[model samples]
Each structure stands twice: as structure tokens, then as C-alpha cells.
Target: MSTYGSRGDVEPMAALAVTLQELGVEAVVCAPPEDEFRALLERAGVEMVAAGMAVKELIAEAKANPHITLPERARKVTSRQYEAVLEVAQKADVIIGSGLMPAAAGARTVADQLGLPFHLVAFQPVTMPSPYQPPVAYPGRPLPPDVTDNRELWKHDAESMNVIFGAAVNDHRVSVGLPPVPSIRAYVLNKRPWLAVDPVLSPWRPSDLLDVLQTGAWILPDTRPLPAELEAFLEADQEPVYVGFGSMAMGNAPAEVARAAVEAARKQGRRLVMAKGWAGLEAIDEADDCFVVGDVNQQKLFPRVAAVVHHGGAGTTTAAARAGTPQVIVPQVVDQPHFARRVAELGIGVAHEGSVPTSESLAEALNRALGMTRRAQEMAGQIKTDGTLVAARELGVA
Candidate 1:
């Protein structure tokens, strides 16, 4: 019930929590403090527990000094929540860990303590059908298994396969005050110890886990319809390209990013719609062809766009995919590159090199995405059909 991270990390859980509430299931979402985030959840009619750290501080530090920032502190808080859960795990029938951070890991500890079943959840496939040394407990469905063994699963090369993540289970045991066990392989979910979580929301094989969970996109209360300015922006223009860096992108020089996007759009003769994210782009004056608006729902927004340019967060990737819009990702760091690779591999989009992407490079990628052939369009359609509700159903919470 407790989770912590940036708004992107916490928002999805908030969405899921709200969806659970609509089904008469009450769930509390926890995260580092951010008033905007609390507002989002509050509008969804979901209860949020703030961890008292300013999310803006975390964003600033992540860009300035990623090695020491909120994620580490968030981990500490999440790990600490286990003491609270330990007291209640016995009364709870099921515990689910949505991410691999302290909260999810802590959930696993308390689950085992109370002998409750737990499932690991993943929003991406990188952690699944794992590539590193295979977890003996759960030998995953090897990627292109015909081409390699379980060891060769993660590393596209054999030499890399020889290297392993080492005995992380022991580390987890130590972190949670549990006895060191054997070099236990992956957890029950992915079968790779390093990729373990409480309950994985695996959609490829609905019955792969105990229950299939659905993706609960954030549900903002029905407010006044898009303001006239935004409505005119969406209606007057041809589907513009969407340029947004969700919760993670706030740390970036967003105005610069938005300006770069403007230059790219001008080159392509397309409009640019920027998501009102943590990235500080709100001050950019809106022109007839360009708009800076707050919180246009991604599920509703991406489809109207010709292409999406983003930082390659998994949730954003999914949103663009659902819209059947090809994506052009400019990955800054972290799991972004991984998601970027998946986009290229799946023909869903292209990944740019970094934060300093040139307008020409971005424009070219946008053209490539906008020019998706009929077959590619069909493929995108297939992906879109993996609806949020389907994700919920798979999780057994629908």
C-alpha cells in the first residue's frame, strides 16, 4: 500500500489505488512530498501519504548529483515501512510489490514473515525473460530462446553472459534482517533473483502469474473541460507532435528542451504540444501553433498527435504506444535507454542519444515515426489493444 519515488513512480500507483477504490477497495499510496502530486491523487479521490521530502529537491539533485538523491532516501523510507507492514501482513491475504525498490522489497520480507503470497509487478519487459545469468528458481522464457541458452538471455553476447549480478538475495536478506540463504536464484516471478518483485503484472501470458493485473492510468476528477486555449490548440492544429518528459524530466532544462522541440516542429511544419510536467516549460509563451498546457490526459492526448518525443520512461512509452503514435525518445539516463531500445526493437519508435539532441535529429526521427507504413501501423494497433483495463484484469484486481 506504501510506495515511494518521483511523481511518475508514485502516480501510477495512485491511479491503481483510485481504480481499486472505485471497485470498493481502499488503498493508500505513499511517496516523497510534492504538492502537485498530492493534488493529482486528491482529485482522483485517493488518499496519499507524503514522506515529507520535497520532490523538487530530489529532481534538482537527480540532475546535479544522481548518485546521491531522493531515490536512495526514498529507498530508506520504503524499507522502513516494512516495520509497519510486518504488524499487518498476517491480517492481509496478499501483498504486491510494484517496483524493486525498498518498498517492494520490504513487502516481500513481510510477506514471507507472515507466510503470505506476493506477486512482483513490472511495467516493462527488461526485468522479465531476463538476460543476465538465469535464476535457477525461475528460468524465464529466453529472449529469442532459439538463438541462445538461459545464460545468453540478457547479454546479446556470450562474454557478457559470463558476468553475473552476484548474490543479491543475501544482500536483500541482510537489508531486511533475514538470515542469509543459499545463493537463491531469481524470485518466483521472473525466475531471476536480481529482477525479483512482489507480483509482476505480466500481460503477455495472462495466466503466467497468480492473477492478471490491469494498468490503472491516473484518473483525474472530471474537471472543467480542457480550457479554451488548450481546446483551441488541440482542435485548430493538425495533430501536433507531443514533447513531454514526465516526472523525471522536470530536472532537465525544460524551457531549453521545449525551445528545441519548437525548432524541430518548425522544421517539420508540425505543431508541438508539451505536457505540463515537472520540466519548467510553463513560462514558454503559447503561440497559435504551439501550446503549453497543464495535464492533458496522455491516453486522450497521444492519439491526436502525429508522433511523440519524450525521455523514454516506460509509462510514457506505453501511452504513446496506446495512441499508436511512434515515439522519438531522448534518453537522459537510467532505465530510459532500456525503454528506448525496446521502442526501436519493436518498431514503435526511435531513441535519440541524449538531452542535447539536435532539432535535425529529432525532426528526422519524427518523420520516420510519422511515416510508419501500414504494416507498422497494424503492429502499433496491436500494442494499443493491450488496454489499461486489460492490465488491471491480469492483475486480478479488475
Candidate 2:
């Protein structure tokens, strides 16, 4: 298994790895060489092979080098994957690729070279092209305003993918003595790519473009106990609103976002449990009602919260749903908006209009979310928790 991105990307792969191990299959994961990722796989008792630069380093480099185009950066990252994943994949019976397209492209090429069966896995349904939904627009490339048809949008999406990764991928493929692929999108997605998402949360519509395997969201059972401080805080409060943007940079003003969340919770007459994630969000003041936590067990904490205010990552959204907690989804980028829309469609949460939210916006969303508590609880029982098990069985490793 190979993946690259934030905790959201790495965590699910780790979960699947753990399940595979239990089924008597020795699993090794190739991912970004970040301390947190290493620790996660270590805890799961799975071997980890560092795939490329750490996610932070990659993001920082992209920011620092403004002259470098997205395509060029993607080329560099994909090239690095060849160096890292090739050796590990040589010993594997099959190759599974996930995370960013460029990284997956590199791993796929290695699989091609080794004559291994390669499978691409998407965490959300939006990543896969379909007539039911349009593809996500590229960073600087927006879809034409006049184009309302999903098929046209997907066609443009394919063109954009080719523009960004076609040369980068084909160049490496040529270097490794493989034939150049005509469509980078098709090559990466393959004929039957797996969708690792909870069907209740994000359903995959059958498409003529590809045969998608919809597995329930890969969830590792988190046994780590919540910190005593957080436990006491939860005990003392009347179901405080839990606010956290897992792995999202939270834009240029993380502190402002944190303050807005705190103020919003206060307006609702509720306590706040803030997670200081990768953006390093901090409390504005040492208020007793606002408790700040770091790297705590969200699985154990979400059930006790009034509502979850989050960035709408696939994993976090699923966790909140499984906990039977209502949500306010303030999406950031990529598949986040899709998850936000799903939450609202399910009547389990409110999707904030934009990425950045002021106190008023957050409070309003929070109010709506709190009102949907009954619906959220009703949906909780429907979410499947056996995604990893199902995926392992599908692999026929046991």
C-alpha cells in the first residue's frame, strides 16, 4: 500500500494495513516520512517505508517557490515516488495507490514495471468521474461558467489532469522503459478503482467511465483513552461543541478561526473543546469554558460533544457521524465541499457557505447543527464500521 497527503490519507491506509495483518497478511505502507505518520503505522504494528518528502516540507517548498508551476512540482514529487516505492513494491504481490494523483501515478508506474496488479483507491466519491457529480476543478483552473453538464465538467477535469501530470508521469514511465500512457487519469484510476468511503456518508453512483468498488470508510478502532483533562472538561460541561480542522492549514489566520469558533460556542451557551491540529490553533484567553486539546482521541470524545465543527475531511465527518453527533462543516478544499454537501443532504449537519467563517456564520451553522441532533443520532446506526475488514476480504489475502 502507498499513499501521500495529510493524516486523513495516511490513517485509512494504516487501518487497512492493521486489518490485513490480523488476516495473516504482512502489510507494509509507503507514505510521507512525517513523524506522526510513522508513529501511526508503528502503533498499528505495520512496517512503514518513507515515500517522499514530508507533507509540511512539500507544502512549504511549493509556497517558497512561486515561480515553479503546479505541474513542475507534481513532476518532482512523482519522480521521488519512483525512487521510494519501486524497491518496496518489487517484493509485493499487488500494489495499492492512494492520496495525491502525482504520488499515485509514480507508484502505478512501478507496479507496471513489476507486472503487478495495481489498484487505485479514493477516499471520496467526488474524485472518481461520474455523471451524477462533476469533478473538482484544478487549483487555478475553474470550470467554464456556461458548462452545467456533469459530463462536460468531467471532460475538462480530464484535460486538466493531463496538463498537470501527463508529462510528469510519462517522463518517468519512459525512464523506467514502459510505454507512455495516453490518459494519465485513466491510468491512475484503472478500470475498477476502489472507493474507501462509508456508503451512508458518500455513496458512489455507477458510472460508464469506471467500475468503482465502494468499501465502507476504513476506520481503525482507536483504543487510546482521552486525556484526563479532556475527560474532566467533558464531564463538567453540558455537551460542548467540538471544533477542529484536522490537517487543514485553516487559511492565513488560524488564530482568527480559533477565536471565531470559541465565540460561536459561547453564543450558543455551550463550552468549547478545540483541537490544536496541524495549524496549531490556540485559545485566545485562558477561559475555563474553552478547553484546548492536542492529538487526543476524537473517536472517544465526539460522542460526548454537542456538535462537531470541522473542515469536513472524510475521516472526521465519518467519525462525527458514527458518534451520533451533529456537525457544522466548514470545508477547506478538494473533496471537503463534497463531504459538506453530503452532511447537509443527509440532514445531519449544516454546510457553511464558504471556507472561512466568522463568529456569526459559525454560530448560525452551529445552531442549525444542534437542531439536527435527532437526525444525526438516527443516521449513526446506519454507518458501517467494517470497511477495513471488507477491503481485506476483497483482497483475498487470507
Candidate 3:
């Protein structure tokens, strides 16, 4: 299957592939060739291939090739990525994939040509129209008070995506020798939709259009031992609060965030573990109790921490949930803010209002999260089931 993005995007696919293997089907994840999560996939013994462009390079290409609109580049990228996975999937009996522009662009059309089953996957309710909540991708800010509880507006979320991206999506169809889809609904509704998230997070809301089967989160846990230094830190007298924003570049913002995190740590009188993410947050100075390190497995670390602080990516959110730790959600992009909202709604964490995390805001959220430990722990127990294996059962992989 093809998948891409940072740890949040690719790691889930790796976990699913591992689960398929456990069900007696050989599976490989085609993902961005990044070492952070790739190392975890490797440790899990799941096969990962470089598919499409790397996240860092994709960003660079967008900046360097500004003449090409992002949507257009997305189309071109997906077109280029079409055959790489199809070449592998067509050989197999079934095709399952998610993540990134290219994989979503052409996988289904190619699978349709071969008359093979293409199981579509989703990490969140961002795409699906739901009665329970607004579309995670809804463009408008602060809902008008009247539409607050109305689930009908949520359906338009998918419609808006189709309206914006329909032509680009059809370009993929024409290239793949498939008929153009009339709408986003036509494009996506043809497949058996598999939602690879915890049912607790994406519980089935009433909907005629979305017959989504919720599998508990597809968690391919990292199996490696933590670095000796990190392990020692965990064993220390004071439990540290964790901080890391995966892959979201913080530009000139890191120093402030670092300062905030340090001050926040000081205010709480707690130790800290700060991950210098993609150079997002650098260590400005040595703090007595804080340890700044590179990407490490959250699966192994969150359990030992007092709380998790990050840019609320699905993987990080799920990891912290499973670890039973409260969270400070400093979301930076799409789907992240949605997860952050869920964190607050479920009483497990705090979701900041905007993108870019400020230290003061993070500290406020962290304090709130610390107070919600009981709720967070309760959620941890509820979402711990393996969604990957459940997905295999649903798709009849066995």
C-alpha cells in the first residue's frame, strides 16, 4: 500500500501492514523515505519503500516551484506516484492504501482497471461527512451560533473538498483511463471505506452516505529500546512532561517555544523531555531538568511521562491516549486542530485555538491536561485495542 507524510501519516500504514502480515498476508508500506518513523517501521520488521517525494523535499519543491500551484504540483506528484504502487498492488490479490496526494489520486482507478478490490482507508473523519460533528476540514472559522449543533453543515465539508479539487481529481482519472467522477462523493463512495482510528475517537455517527467501519487505531508500536540517556531520564526521581512537534517547521518560532516550554517546566517544577523536531524547537540553553533529543518512539516514552505536549498529529494524539497521559495540543496544520478539539471534548487534553504554539498557551494547555489525568487514563484503556488486526478481520484478510 502507498502512504506518505511524517510519523503520523506513514507510521499508521506501517502498523496496518504489520497487522496484515500477522493475518498471513504479506504487505509493504510505500512511504516518504524519512528516518524518524522509518526507523520505527524497520524495528517493527515492516517493509517500507520510498513512494512519491519526501516531506521535506516536497516542501522545498513547492517553494522553489511556486509557478506551479500547490494543487497542480499535487496532481503531478500523484500522477508520478501512480504506477509505483500499482505495479506492486496489481500483482497482489488486493490493494489497500492511504496518505498523500499521489496515492489518493490514482490508486483506485488502477485497481478498478485490474478489477481488484481497493480498500480505501482514513485516519480521521476529516473527509467523511458526519452527523456527530462538523467536517474537520470546514474552511470557515468560528461557527455561527445557530449552526453549532447542526450536523447537516458537516456534510458540506466533503462537498467543498470535491468542488475545490474535482478537476484535479478528474485529471488523474483521464490519465488512468477511467471515467471522470461527477463529484467527490462519486469519486470516493465507490469503495468500501475503512476508517483506521479508534472507535472512541471516530465512533459511528448516523449517516446514510458514510457506512464507515471503525477499527481501533492501527498501532504498529516501536519495539526498540530507548537510548540509554533517555531511559535514565525516565528512571529519574521527577517525571518529565514531554514536548515535540513532529515535522512542522517552526521557522523563527522555536526559541520562543523553547523558552515557554522551559518556563512552563519551571512553573510546574517538573522535568522535561523536548524533541527538537525537524529543527523546529532547538535547545536555546541548558536547563537543569530538561533533555532535548531527536525523534524517539512515543509508544515507549509517553507511558513514562507525566504528560505529552506536541502538535496534535493523529499518531501523537493516539499514542498519548494509549499511554493514559494528558496532552497539550499545539496543532500546526490540517487534521491536527481537529484532533486537538477532540482532545478537549473528551476531557483528555487541551487544544490551542490556532496554528503555531506559543509557550504561554502551551503551558496553560499543559496545566489543564495535568488536571485531566483521570479522564486521559480512562480513555487510554478504552482505545488500546489493535485497529490493524480488526481491519484485517473486516476486510476478510484471513
Every candidate's CA RMSD: 6.8, 1.0, 2.8
Per residue, candidate 2 scores C-alpha lDDT tens digits across 205-312 of: 786877998989999878889988888988985889999998988879899999899999999999999999988999989789989998878889999999999999
Better of 1 and 2 by lDDT: 2
Query: Which is the winner by TM-score between candidate 1 and candidate 2?
Result: 2
- Estimate the TM-score for candidate 3: 0.90
Error of 2 at 363 (Å): 0.8
Off by over 4 Å in 2: none
Worst 10 residues of 1 by lDDT: 192-201
Ranking by TM-score: 2, 3, 1
Model 1, CA-based lDDT: 0.58
TM-score of each: 0.71, 0.98, 0.90
* Index of the highest-lDDT prediction: 2
Q: CA shift at 352, candidate 2, in angstroms? A: 0.8
Give candidate 1 regions above 4 Å deviation: 22-24, 51-55, 59-75, 83-91, 132-177, 180-224, 250-253, 282-288, 373-377, 384-398
Global lDDT of each candidate = 0.58, 0.91, 0.74
> Per-residue lDDT of 1-398 in model 1, one digit per residue for the tens?
54556655666666566666766666665555678777777777776665435657755556677565343544454455565556545556666555434455556666776777765555544434433333222122224646546444433322222212113333555776677543222332423112211121123333222233334333222344556777677888577888888765534466677777888887889988877676656535646667877666677677678888888776677667766778888886556777677677777788786666667777787778777634345555454332334435545667
**Model 3 segments more than 4 A misplaced:** 136-159
lDDT of 1 at 262: 82
